[model samples]
Target: MNKDNLAARRAALIEQCAEQRVGLAFELNALRPSKVMAGLPLAGYVAANRKLALGAAGAALGLVLMRRKRLAGVATSALSAWKMARGALGILAQLRR
Candidate 1:
C-alpha cells in the first residue's frame, strides 16, 4: 500500500539522521580541545585591558632590571643545563630509533 511505503521511507530517513547525528557528535568531541584552546580569554582580556597589561609588563621589567646580575647568572646556568638535557634526550631518541 502507499501508506506502508511512506512509513518505511520515513523510518529509514529517521534512522539515517540518527546515524549522522552520532557521527557529528564524535567529530565535535574530537575538535573540542582545539576549540577550547583557540577560544582562551587571556589574550582577548589583555587586549581589552591595556592598562593592566602594561602595568604587569612594567613590574616585570623593573624586577628583571633590579636583579640583572643575578638573573643573568641564573639564565646562563639554566641555558647550559637545558642544552645538556636536550642533548641527552636526543641521544636517547636516536638509540630508540
Candidate 2:
C-alpha cells in the first residue's frame, strides 16, 4: 500500500481504539464498588447508621480483647459439648437401625 493509505489506516485504527477505551471506561464505572454498594439493601442501612455500625464493631473488638481467656474457655466447653452430642446422636442412630 502507499504511505498515504497506510497512514490513513493507522489513524483510523487509533481512533477506533480510543473509542473502545472510552466505552470500556463507561461500562466499568457501573461496576465500581460505590455504585454496586448503593444498590444493596444492607449498604443503604449501614450508610444510614454508620455511627451505630462503627460503635458496635468497636465494642465487639473491646470485648474480645478484654475477655480473651474467658472466651477461649467458653469456646472449648462449647466444642466439647458439640462433640459429645454428636457421638450420642451417632449411637442413637445405630441403635435405631
Candidate 3:
C-alpha cells in the first residue's frame, strides 16, 4: 500500500485496539448517548454566527491595539520633551542670572 494508506491502516488498528480495551462496541451506535439533539439542522446558522463573531472580534482587537500603540507613542514624545525642558532649566539656573 501507499504511505498514506499504510498510515491510515495503522491508525485504524490502534483505534480498534483502544476501543476493545476500553469495552467500547465497534459501531457507529457507540456515539455519545447524551448528545442527541432532536431539532432542525442548523449548520448554516452555526457557520454564519461563527463568521460574524470572528470578524467582529478581530476588528475590535485590531482597533484596541492600534489605539494603544498611538497613545504610547504620544506619551513617549511628551516625556522626552518634558525631560529636555527640565535639563535646559537646570543648565540656565547654573549660569550667572
Candidate 4:
C-alpha cells in the first residue's frame, strides 16, 4: 500500500529485465499486474443498463407483432368486401341482359 515502496519495486523489476538480456522499450507501460493481485472492476451500471435496453426491445417487438396481426386481419376483411361487391355487380349485369 506504500507508494514509495511500490515505485522502488517497479524500478527493480525494470532493472531485473535488463540483467535478463531483455530490451527496455515503451512496451513496459502495457504490463499489468496479475489478476490474483489486481481485483477486477465491477460493471454495475453497464449490466443494469443492458437489462433495461433488452426489456425495452422485447416490449417494442411485441407491440410490432400485435400491430402486424391487426393489420393482416383488416387487409383480409377489405379484400373480402371487394370480392363481394364485384360478385353482386356481375349478377346485376346478367339480370339486365
- What's model 1's overall lDDT? 0.85
Which portions of model 2 show Cα errors greater than 4 Å?
Answer: 38-97
Q: What is the C-alpha lDDT of each candidate?
A: 0.85, 0.89, 0.73, 0.72
Please give each candidate's TM-score: 0.38, 0.41, 0.31, 0.32
39-76: candidate 2 lDDT, tens digit per residue: 79899778778999999999788767867788888779
Candidate 4 per-residue lDDT, tens place, 6-93, comes to 9999999988988665443434534533333344433444344678878888977866777777878977997999999999999999
Number of clashing residue pairs, candidate 1: 0
Q: Candidate 2 has what TM-score? A: 0.41
**Which portions of model 3 miss their true places by more than 4 Å?**
1-66
**Who is ahead in lDDT, 1 or 3?**
1
Between 2 and 3, whose TM-score is larger? Answer: 2
Q: In model 1, what lDDT does residue 48 have?
A: 67
Specify the highest-lDDT model's number: 2
